[model samples]
Target chain A: MNIGSLLGAIGQGFIWGIMTLGIYITYKILNVSDLTVDGSFATGGAVFAVTALSNIHPTICLFIAMFVGGICGLVTGILHTKFKIPAILAGILTQLGLYSVNLRILGDKANISVAPVSTNITFLANVLNIPHTRAGMLLGIIISIMCILLLYFLLGTEFGASIRATGNNEKMIRALGVNTDNIKLFGIILSNMLIGLSGALLVQMNKYADVGMGKGAIVYGLASIVIGEVFFRRFSNFGIKLMSSVFGCIVFFIIRAFVISLGLKANDMQLLSATIVVIALAMPIFKENINIRKVGKINSLNEMKQVSSSDEIVKEKIEKREVTEVGGGNNA
Target chain B: MLKLKNIYKTFNSGTINEKRALDDINLVLNDGDFVTVIGGNGAGKSTLQNVISGTIMPDFGTVEINGINITKYPEHKRAKYIGRVFQDPMLGTASDMWIEENLALAIKRGENRSAFKWMIDNNNSLFFKEQVAKLGLGLEDRLKTKVKLLSGGQRQAITLLMSTLKKPDLLMLDEHTAALDPKTASLVLNLTDEIVKTSNITTLMITHNMRDALNYGNRLIMMDQGRIIFDVAGDEKKKLTVEDLLQKFNTTKDAPSDAMILG
Candidate 1:
């Protein structure tokens, strides 16, 4: 692939990695299928583009985007937990609602640009006197690293434990006297915040935000998480899992870049992602079945041995009883 | 102490499949009271425990712990006062979490806010280790082991210990030992008795085994349909046999099934 194309792909992939982290938080840590990603992704981009044009600092604009994303997540959590809506349905409702809200945020435009103003990464890149591609990559890497560190610290906290427990087993966590609704809300908010921030960064990197930027975002995120989990299944440690997820996103991007270089059409991206996720999800089930078959064979062998041993024991008991009877007769 | 007054629960209300899971159930458990509940399938044993634990809200009732009415309280809100162990060993604790981590969570039960530190203090860990050592299952040495690695009996033992760690106002055991082998079940039951007696915590244990129901607990309750049909205590409960229980059940209802008799 050409250097520019490669760098462009890498930069885009890096931005997408943030959304993967958000997906990891909701899907892996919280163990909930949140569909709010589609709308929230665009929401982040719109918020960032609109805010940045109004003379706000680009970093602050990103923060505002993340905050809006968190609000969207909070609404989804409220719908699911307090109102007793099914989680998937709640996400769908929120996503549907976000479209109109996103339109309003964009002032009825299908897409918007912050080209005339100081874009976050471009400004930073100019100040640093670095090439746009290098600047984008540098910015993406630093933000991702910071995000990962923040998550690592947060997950180590007590509230984080509660959130993890909520994912693993809500009933057990509730029994621990945790108001799980609060934890769910907290988790959703945090997850969407990262997602929105990623969207904001993408707009700055690409020089514009579009209404359809979030399309297939969920699939992309799922692919990353699945790929990461498949790669890190052997690690029992939580820290390892987190690292693997980040690596998974990067690896997914590299693979996508390779596919594009091989002359695959852009439309094929969705199909490839779907296939990857299917394979990743199916791997565990395939392994489990293989293990079960092995155990079943061992159990049958043990059963046969048990049957023979019981029969031998019964025969020995009968002979002993006969001998005792004969000895008693002789004594008499 | 725990009290349930005129509790009524109907599942799928206003439907063809409507079932009155609990009806006019009035019960009071004094501190240190270990009650064993027995019944056949669909006897409302689990429903009663659920209501008390706030998993299921009673249609009409007042559930009070130490005279505090928690009838309107939600499940997570009521968790502070009530400790519960489910029939499925997997349901009571997070399988992926370390045994110590699970213990830490149980220790923090009822706390308004959890501390930020991941590790408990050395002294607290020592105390938990001591508590775990009492199980005599060598779990004290396996405190760092994930709970998923433990056997059903071992997990149940740990769950029982965890539930009583905070000495909750009321403890509910929903056939917690039913999933284990006979030997392991008896061992857990013995541990239950020792823990309840020593801690002086009020407890409600549901069981499918008639012999266990008769052999354990200070009070024995036999539920039929959706209400308590028989309540026996003290010397009467001590003198009771499996045969006596079978007869009572037969007289109170129809012919008791052989499987019910066996359990």
Candidate 2:
């Protein structure tokens, strides 16, 4: 990719990478495949557009967008945790419902361009008076670093620990006297809040928000997470994992930019992203199945040793019985 | 400190698979009462613990802990008063969390957990290392290691430590050592006894092993078909022999096949 295009791709990646952090909470930590991002992303953009049209501060609009997105997640969380709905279906339902909600926020219009811009165009450009192209790159880096730091600290706190524990073992957390439903609700809320903030940033960068802005957003998020995990699989520290996930986002966007330059059509983008996510998701399961084909897929050497020792004991007993019994050779 | 009054529960009610899991069960545990429960598969031993822990609510009964009606409370709410370890080592502790982190979570049992304070504070971490050191499994030095990397015995020990950290009003162990090897199982059972003795926590343990049932607790209870068939304690329980228990177990034709093999 050309230098300018590559920088632009990185900028776009940083915005989506913020959303990827949200997905990390639901997908990796909370262990819930929240499909709400497809809708929550648009909800964020819609809220930002509506609030900005009313002459609100851009930063305030970002908070409003996140608040709206968090509500969407709260709906999904309640449905899954309390109303007895399956998690995926609950997220799907919220996502589907947000279609009309997003439309309403957009004043029943499909698109709202930030023309004759109400406030200075980009966050970095407005605040730092930097060139537009450089501002884009700078904005991405700043937001990403901010999110990584916040998440690292949050996940270290008691509430965050319980939330992670809730994702890790629901029964264990509940046994430890944590009201797990509340913890899950908070996790979903926090995750979608970041996703909404990312959406707001995307709208500012593109200078327009569309009703279909969130289409395939979940695929991208998952792709970013998978890519990040593939590269940082060995880093167990929470901050490193978050930073790598954002790094994954930047790489994913840059690669997409390069492929587009190679004549990939806009209509084909969704299909390509979907395929990438499917492959990433299936790789681990495929590995397990391959292992299962080999002697019951013993996970560790300790188990293998146990199995072999049991076999040796049986062999020794048969030999001992042969020596003690007459005509044992005929029986064998 | 714990009471189950006429607890009745049924699964798949009105269906061909309908079976009564708890049949008007009544139980009372005094503070520091360490009771061992023995039963065959599907004998409702697990169902009893589940009811107490609020994982399963009795269809028609009241559960009271320390004079409060807890039958209507949710499972998480009841956790404030109850500690539990499952047969599967994975169930009692978060595998992804560190060994010390697991204990940190445990120490907060029955307390507000939504605070924003640092989870692994120096005070808590030091306390965890010291408490784990007492297990004598060399886990004290590996506080940062994830619980998943530990052996089954180690995981069970950590889980046990977690359950008893703050001394729950009642501790329930549902075949906690059944998944471990014989030697490991014995080791965990011994550790369990030590913890119970030192903490003086009220405990209810269900074991498929009849010998363990008779040997570990201050009281022993036998169950068949969702009913407490025999209860013994103190001098009377001490005089009982394994052969007598096995003979008694075999008299019931539907007794667990494995119970007959008990020594």
Candidate 3:
């Protein structure tokens, strides 16, 4: 209810934003579901917690966490590409495998606490010479911005275009002389690494790493991406879109804070989030059907196609566009 | 030069869906031959192109391009040596990408995609504009427009441009104009002829339209049941009429569709 509580939510949102940005690479750009986020997120936290306790530099621990997360993605990529497993199932397999791996990393504990001596909170506050209340928000903003800028630049590169093309038309790009399998592998790895990095940072903000911390991470990530597209889709610039993903999390957290202040129990949060996501996802489909009925003249077949290669969410958008196109045919 | 010797392929082998997509295909093309192929659906026209391009491996064949045996190369790896345009307009280009971005991707078709290179080089923008302008679709002015907005005819035109941009060692067109309207199909065919002749790029084009297959290439080949039923070139090809070709096709139980044979 208070400003402090709201700021705390924003801090949490920023960390989630970072993870979604990682999701954005796979879900939005590469067009892969990459369900490895849940497992990779926990791996990152576990790795970060243990490394930070051993007094390794905080920044170095973050890199280590990211690398470990990337390896998880690589494994999923191999399972999908080399072993011919479906992408989502490949990610689920890795996620399930990482459960045991996460236990070992946590020294068989379900949770590990990084106490007051940890380098993430108070240590960061001392370095910045600011109060603990303000340190997290400031760090979150700065790091998120840095991550955004990096993504903006990378996606604009030739290789980045190839990644986008891979999601868009795997066969076309393949005919263009790109080994799409390798491109897919790189995309999955990069996405998981970013998720891992975000997970490591999220644990520090909470001052603890729990085995279950990453549960429903994909839902959270997808919610942020869908919300960002819903609210800020007007801006097509890659950088602004990336910022919008983070901005969406901030808005979502703020909304949660308002709802909680209105007397909603904390236990209802997950249910509320799930419902919101369901609506966000189905809104396009429902709208598309409505448009079809409105037109009333469309044929059974209207040249719609399954060409976007991947991204279940984007596939919905494709259908939405097809129906809209049918209605818009006369206007054009 | 391109060569295919003893290429054999069977899909869904030993099943109810079993099909011999390719059967002992042996072909040789000297540089800049500009051949056209015609066949009905399931005639293995696409399979022959796919085998040469490595889209599908031949069961028993050595595909040699320019005297190098490239049967073992993957599809993308073979891309450095060939250019291809598919029948479906959507299959040849990425729709969501900008007109120029698609060209930039084609420009890097055979090169290693570098992380540091700008996606579309500024220096090449003018060249792209010129190339797009040459399409005469007014696409030059709208280089930044997503390809999705382009009409089927316009997309086919750009796809043709992309295929020949590098003067590929061999250019393959698989019914590239079938999706276009009559007027646009002729326009694209003319463009295809212009691009092929100027570059002198050895090319193979497949068409259901009998006239396009007969008129567009120096050599004309017909396939039926995965076998090249007829092959003719130069004066012999030029003298042939649509009726003669249809007559040749009728000799086989499986024949081209009436619409295609009569086109």
Candidate 4:
């Protein structure tokens, strides 16, 4: 692909990276695959479009869109927590209902174009004397960093630890006196707010918000998260993990741009995104299976048994050593 | 102190496979009482603890802690006064959390968790390290280690510490060390005794091991088919032996299982 197109793809990737971060909150941290993004994403863009058209300041429009997205998440949360609906089903219900809600927000239109140079990204470019693509990328980087910092701070807080614990072990957290339902609601709301913000940014950059723009958005978000995780597997830092989602999205778009440049149809990109997620998800399992096959090829049964048992013994010895070293350190 | 008055629970009430888990049960625990419960499979031992802990609401009864009736309290709401360690080592802890984080959650039990406060401060970390050091497992320095990496015995010990960290009004352990090897089980059981004794917390621990039931606590109750068939405490419980418990089991409609005999 040409350098210009590659840069444009990277810019789009950063904008969508915000949405991927939103999905990461639900998908990775909360351990719930919330389908509400398909609906909330479109809702975000539509809210931003309608608000920006009213001569509202572009920055304020972004917050408005994010608030509207949180409302969408609240609906899903209520359906899941209060009504006792399954989380995935509740997300689906909200997503399906959002289609009509999005249409209503769009003034009963299928799409609205903000293609005029007065749109925020273009305005930013004009103000800064930079290209529109460059302005979009700059905005994406700024917002993504702010989001990462905010999440890192919040997740380190007491309530945030409870939220993470709720996702990890609902029964255990509940037993420890956390209201898991409330924590879940808060998580969903925070997740969708970021998603809505991403949607607004995407509309600003693309110059249009279509009711169908969020179709299969979950797959794209998952693809970004999965790809990012595959690349940054060794880092356990939460901030780095969050940044990886954005990085994953940028890489995803770069690959897509290159693939499109190879004369692939745009309609085929959804299939490609789904394929990327599947491969990333299965990569660890595939590695394990290959290791098992290698072990199976060992001609001696004693060596095979030793391979399995020796690992555990070695791990135990290492852990024992570490504990003693720490104890010794305290004594000295 | 805890009280269970006229507690009754039935599973699959109308079905052919209907089973009465707890029937017209009544239990009362005095302050500083540590009760060990033993029973055969499906003897409602777990059901009794579940009812007390609000895991399952009794059909007709009231659970009172310090004379405050909590019959309608949800499990999480009642967690403020009650601490529980489950049979499975994995169930009592969030496996992905650090040891210090788990202890932090434990310390915050029954208090409103504020989003503004940092969960792990240096003070609490120091306090936790000191508390863990008392376990004598060399885990005091490994505060940042995730719980999943710990052995079953270590996990149970950590869980025991977490359950008692806040010094709840009541502690309930449902076979907390049953999954460990004999040596580990004994270690955890001794730790349980030390923590309970030091805090003087009211506790109800369930175990399939008859010897442990007899050896650990000041009171022992044997259950059979949804009712407490025998209750002994104080000097009487202290004098009871495994043979006495076996003879008592023989008097029931069903004989003791090999596991109980081995114990």
lDDT of 3 at A292: 53
Please name the candidate that would achieve the greatest DockQ relative to the true structure.
3
Q: After best superposition, candidate 4 residue A144: deviation in angstroms?
A: 1.0
Write down the C-alpha DockQ for each prediction.
Answer: 0.35, 0.47, 0.62, 0.44
Name the regions of candidate 2 deviating beyond 4 angstroms.
Answer: A120-123, A285-332, B250-253
- TM-score of the A chain in model 2: 0.85
User: What are the per-residue Cα lDDT tens digits for candidate 1 across B73-117?
Assistant: 888888788888888998888887888878877887867654367
Interface RMSD of each: 7.9, 5.8, 1.6, 3.9
Ranking by lDDT: 4, 3, 2, 1
Between candidates 2 and 4, the DockQ winner:
2
Q: Candidate 2's residue-wise lDDT over A64-107, tens digit each? A: 99999999999999998899798899999999999999999898
CA error at residue A62 for candidate 1, angstroms: 1.0
Identify the runs in model 4 with alpha carbons over 4 angstroms from their true place: A116-119, A288-332
Q: How close is candidate 3 to the true structure, as a TM-score?
A: 0.93
lDDT of 4 by residue, B118-173 (tens): 99999999999999999999999899988988888999999899999999999999
TM-score per model over all chains: 0.89, 0.90, 0.93, 0.92
Off by over 4 Å in 3: A291-332
Give the docking tier of candidate 4: acceptable
lDDT of 2 by residue, B80-100 (tens): 889898999989889989998
Reported per model, the fraction of native interface contacts reproduced equals: 0.65, 0.81, 0.83, 0.81
Candidate 4's residue-wise lDDT over A1-332, tens digit each? 89999999999899999999999999889887799999999999999999988888888999999999999999999898889999999999999999999999999999998775266788789899999889999898899999999999899888889988988889898999888998889899999999999999999998888999899899999999988988998887889999999999999899999989999987689999999888877875585555444444442344536666666555454456556555554343
For model 3, the docking class works out as medium
